[model samples]
Target: MAEAAPERVYTEQEVEAYLGENLPHWKLERGWIRRTYRTHSWKSTLMVVNTVGHLAEAAWHHPDITASYAWVEVRLATHSAKGITDKDFALARKIEDVVCWQPGREGGPLEGTPAGDPRFAYIKYDKT
Candidate 1:
């Protein structure tokens, strides 16, 4: 079997450019790309953590996560490559897509959590 090639490590400038164009909510800090998701409560925070954990496990690229009663922060870096890489960006994109999805806005069957009802509220979706 052939070994895979080394992943390319992105420079600070490159990371910044990608974040600006594709991931406006994510930022570069201390060689890691980070994003903080605000949730409605502790239950929502755990949901976010578990969602991210599943995604990271499936992708085989993990991130450092911090969670409080109302927020979850995810930080990604390529530890093996010693810097940010494509994997970090890819995982970040997937996380953002799943976490920020609002089915109600798409006119789909899933009405999404009722924003007005605190009982069903989960993530605090950012207004466009």
Candidate 2:
């Protein structure tokens, strides 16, 4: 029987190149990949968390998730590698697909926010 090759820790240049033109919503932070999904209410927050939980379980790669009334922040890294790896990016892409899904909207993504959606307006990240 052959043993599986160990996963290599990604160089910053390799990671950046892989992201290419479609950066999605993830950001690199201190060796981790992080993203925060802001929702309109507690229900939406719970939905995101639950969906992520299921996906992570199936992927066998878990993330540090912080859930709040109007947001769910996820931080992903390959803990075994002590840094980000392909697994983090793969899972991040899956999460983004779930986030953009629209169950009954004819395949288009769900609307983001209205002109004055308070939940979207108050997040300080919005300023940047």
Candidate 3:
């Protein structure tokens, strides 16, 4: 038999503590945890949406995605449980990894992102 998926609903404290350490930009609110990724242009927004689309589809767990001119917000919660669950946390990490991806890394193809272009660089994180 296939292993069952984790159904444990994370307490508010657990959600805050884990997202605080791992996904600093994500915030808990309205019984959900979410983050909005700012992009440089409409094209960048499209790229972010497409990336999230594929990831969510592959994981078989989707979040409410809102894409606008230069930003995309992803919200996650286990609707069945009326709260967050381990699956939400797992997928959130995967989304973060790809959403903040840098070029030349093993990730979603940068076909739309211009080659070696500095303007495409969104908020740069220290290379620490």
* lDDT of predicted model 3: 0.82
TM-score of each: 0.97, 0.75, 0.79
Ranking by TM-score: 1, 3, 2
Q: Candidate 1: what lDDT? A: 0.96
* Winning model by TM-score: 1
**Tens-digit lDDT track of model 3 for 13-113:** 99999999988888899899998888777887888888988999999988999988878889999888789998788889999887776665546665444
Best of the candidates, lDDT: 1
TM-score of predicted model 2?
Answer: 0.75
Clash tally for model 3: 0
Candidate RMSDs in Å, in order, are 0.8, 4.6, 4.3
Would you list the C-alpha lDDT of every candidate in the order shown? Answer: 0.96, 0.76, 0.82
C-alpha positional error of residue 57 in candidate 2 after TM-score superposition, expressed in Å: 0.1
- lDDT digits (tens) for residues 49-102 of candidate 1: 999999999999999999999999999999999999999999999999999999
Lowest lDDT sum, 10 consecutive residues, model 3, at 119-128
